[model samples]
Target: MYDNEYFVVDLGNCTTTGEIINNLSLALETLNHTGKSIVLKLNDNYLNQSQLLSIQSLITSYGCSLDTIETTNPETIAIVENMNIFVQKPIEKRVADKYDTQEEINSFQPFSMPKAEEKKDIIALKDVNNLHFEADLDALKRQQESIDISSDLKEAGINPKEDFHTIDYQVSSQYTRPQEVLNEADNFSKSDTAVFVQQNMSKAATMELEKEFENAEKNSIGVYKKAYDENNFQEDSWEEVDFYETATTSPVISDSKSTTYVNQTLRSGQILESEGNVVIIGDCHPGSEIRAIGDITVWGVLSGIAHAGMSGNTNAKIRALKMNAVQLRIGSCYSRRPDGTNIPYILRSSIFTPEEARVVDGEIMLFKINQN
Candidate 1:
């Protein structure tokens, strides 16, 4: 018998960090209905420092406080204490030298701080290799040229780690192995995470290059080639593929069409996003949400947030079989479910009938669909 205000989250045998994050997302969504804080009642589950910190950050962003934490285990108690210390004031403060008393300093005189040590440069040695060259002087000249290039790039704020550090050797001639060039593409830095190959490569080479880019956290891979014999390269010749989603996908579209249909009810924390119009055949729970580019048509009770014209379609509208939405948005206009006292008589009577929300005079207003 908990209070009516607070949203209670029961952590039942869910010890993993992933489970905690998923559950907390749902709990946060549900808390939107009551505008109350969240309470996690731990049942044989413990959260580590990282998990607690993530939870604290999530709730803070939601504009809702983590009200209470109930746990019985001693391990859980220690974790909670760490969370309190993390959230409390005075995270880090510098004290003045004179803040401490002379007597106190004298008592701890033997534990005086050590002097700041001077930093020493470290030199690494590499294995020597003998290679056939035109002349020893030529090798030395190439080494000097590489050094000059590296220094120039560093002065220009272009980190050479992506180029020089990753490359086994520079391709000085056309006879240089393509495999070596492919290998050098693996080296990625914070600034430059991509490699450009001007030479024409085969499909196999392109596939290998894309694989390397995927490992280097690069999304866009550009392969430039001449489109015609005249050397006029159009934008079509510059082939580019977005590798971000193929390696690791973001939120995906469940259905794609002018009118997308959802057969099942949306649970807490479940988000339904559509490129075109959306039609939900089931109820939208309190924590659920639906965002459509065109219109939103709900055949069941709609208690969640519904956004129509998400892609800037100003003529879009939201229609629900039972008009009990927490909030409705049509284009730039939005309206929340009015309180009992504020709800109009016509709107109240059509709660069971079909009700639509549309933008009227730059504001979202509710209207009932006529049966005649």
Candidate 2:
């Protein structure tokens, strides 16, 4: 909880340094911590000197000062002593002490169960009936007597005074015979030869439908090519549209190029560059940049700028589970998200369409790696 004067960050639930930093950063970003003092609460969670300094720096960045630290870890206390920050017992310990004091005070007080007279009064209240409820019941009886039951029965085609056994029930003649019996009789009347012919006709019809489906699948490739040609036409010939024609020399694809793997989320203002290839195991947020000489592959969403084939290796490509990059560059070619495209700053979705972007001829083209 935070107030105008102080903001308390409870890192006691976090078990790792990364979790602590991530939680602290999120709290700073989402809360109004400006010009206030901060109190960090930790429970038996160790923090080294560098980690404490980073936390201090992070607090200062939000225009807040680290005033006090409530921690149960001795290591954390030692680190805070040199940092000139006040230390105190954790909130959990303080709350436990308060409860203990209250219990001790309660022990000396006089208390007893309810007396017999008070118990009798409580039991008598449960047996008390409401006079208004009895009046409502009498009113309901008067209303029920006013309703004309004979008229309702006559309207429903029943004589109110007639015995139930004496009443006549007229049934439709068509439904006199049970439907199942009629069906069984009809099936028995059909000849065996006729039944065989009917089954053969149904089998032939099913086979014909299966053949049609097979034919449709075989011609799917031609249909896709026709649709592609109709929508991807340019004013100039496809061969003449060389956007990156200046790069005439091709760089050799080294067999031993090292690959770098990053396992943390790349926040804004973070830049990751690799000489060969770069693989990110997490999301690349907006305002971050990634440059690789060989290839770039993101296991998560790529919502930032990414440049592959920085040294003119046009063969290099960029791939991601969700391809929503702000700008994409491959070799000498540069491309950006189309104008008026609605790209969210942060994408959280259960469904992901893996896509790959590569230089096709002289233009960057995206291709779906899997069909839904």
Candidate 3:
């Protein structure tokens, strides 16, 4: 049995290129050579996920049974897909030209800017086959004459009102009720049915006739001349329907290496360093800081500070004896209190304990990491 003495191994300020140590398993083997189970005392606070996984893997590889792998604040990185949709109003249906000076019209007068393929609006209608003209035959001729009018008025180069002879026909078609046809089978269901004397005819033949009658009575979208909600009408032919879930998938962390803290403040101008877990023993002076890519714990007073989880580890935490730090964070998130107002308590006080920083409304909360 060993005496009541603790052997401290200060992991010298080492430069870790990426998330995982180059030879993590070998590093763990060296730690286990002491014949002591791995008790990672993170001198530098600020533990990121990649380093956490690396350290855990190292200890396990060395078969150094975790005597007490104390990790505070199980950092949680979350990417909630918020669906705030921008709804666009459907296009409106413009008024169609259908009214005639005398004759009835059916459809809209679709305008086109004389495509090379199609014939121009210039009509040979006047010289066409013999036909009976409408009652207002003079007006009909005048309307046709309007399309062939001089290019000046057509291009808005000159207003027709300035011309004496121009009648200025502002004629437009008015919508009319469609001609309704009465069906002979309107009351076919209530009408008398004659019994068939033919023996060769099967019951199946008789049933088919009845089924057709039932279908005609049932209402449908096609049965109506217009859509149910014409004001908000959208042509089904132009619209499409398909699954959009694939386009709205969650993000995947491609490389864990990119998940380490980049911007960091080292203790003094000496450049603070870390391997995995970093612990702060005293209150850090303003402008004087410490940064690491692992867990951060302050056993003493913590003052001027820019605490953060520069890496993308949402599970990383900031725990202190007093947590009124100026800045706090885990991963890309930044948790901070106002200047002068945040008085971080870092003493071995009754209220302060070694715990992981938890989240209370997205902001970091300093509390016992495992009181739960």
Candidate 4:
């Protein structure tokens, strides 16, 4: 407030005690003032007695004038008045002369009051901008996310930087010993291939599995065979043997005709020639031929040629579960449907039945199943 005789310091909005100390210190060092009065213009900030004592000491040591302190707030004015510092009024003298005596000023002790000491961690603005002391939470999270697990492993000594040969300690010695590997190789080297396979591949289990598969296949075939026997009762008389065996066997006696049983199906282009009766447990498909000196009985469908009683016994009969023959011969006599050609569409309905064919009055004739 004094014109040009005093140096003025306006600590504009210096909110913190640290900021007030810094501004006041800057003013004391920078300003050109000898014994001239110096004024501190605090807008509304209040300084505690401890801070005021420090400021008073700095002013006294610096030999600067700190007689009149200006503040707008009544609370600040009360604090400055207690400090024994000069307070200027408009067109009037200082208020310290009227309010406080020299003895009271000499006895002023800011330390005598019971006040809590506030500690301020003060850092220069330049130092704050230059140093990275605190970590940003979001930046730290991003950095952690970018860190590689391999690098962490490296830090944990899981994957050492040294070469394998250079490493003296045995980290993997527990997992595998050299003596154990040599013993394993020595034990297996003398064994044959079969022994090696049996020991290493667990071939016993594999063989057991194969036997189980074979048994399952046999059981499935037995089930199908049981079903075939139940439906075609005449197949019980037939033996499950190769068809070629029937053709290659020795010729039977002229008086006694030997019965030959074939269990498998006769496909097209196959021929079964027997010296006596021919019993087929399975189907005789189209284009197959069966020639027997005696009766010919088929347990399944007979869709091919059948020649029975080739030695001229017209009484020999041919029976089947389904008989769709292309031609039926009994004692050298041939019989067929009304149509000359064996068209499956017509023959299926006429001949395909559980019927029998025989020589009736010297003519090959199809007849209904005769139980007698």
Pick the TM-score winner: 2
Q: Would you give me the overall lDDT of model 4? A: 0.56
Residues 228-260 of candidate 4: C-alpha lDDT, one tens digit per residue: 112234464355546797678886444433677
lDDT of each: 0.53, 0.62, 0.36, 0.56
Cα RMSD to the true fold for all candidates = 31.8, 35.2, 39.7, 55.2
Which of candidates 2 and 4 is the stronger one according to TM-score?
2
Per-residue lDDT tens digits of candidate 3, residues 105-214?
11212111223233222233333311222223345457756876567575977655454232222112232212221122232232121111011122222334454555
> How well does each candidate superpose onto the true structure, as a TM-score?
0.29, 0.32, 0.25, 0.29
Across 87-201, the per-residue lDDT of candidate 2 in tens digits comes to: 6655445543553442342232111222334433433433343233345446755885798688788889998666222122221222132334333433533333233223433
lDDT (10s digit) by residue, model 1, range 158-189: 88775344212211212333465465555523
lDDT order, best first, reads 2, 4, 1, 3
Q: Which is the winner by TM-score between candidate 3 and candidate 4?
A: 4
TM-score of candidate 1 to 2 decimals: 0.29
Q: Cα lDDT for residue 86, model 4?
A: 51
Q: What residue runs in model 1 are displaced by over 4 Å at the alpha carbon?
A: 1-257, 341-351, 370-372
Poorly placed runs, candidate 3 (over 4 Å): 1-271, 306-308, 338-340, 344-355
* Clash count, one per candidate: 0, 0, 27, 0
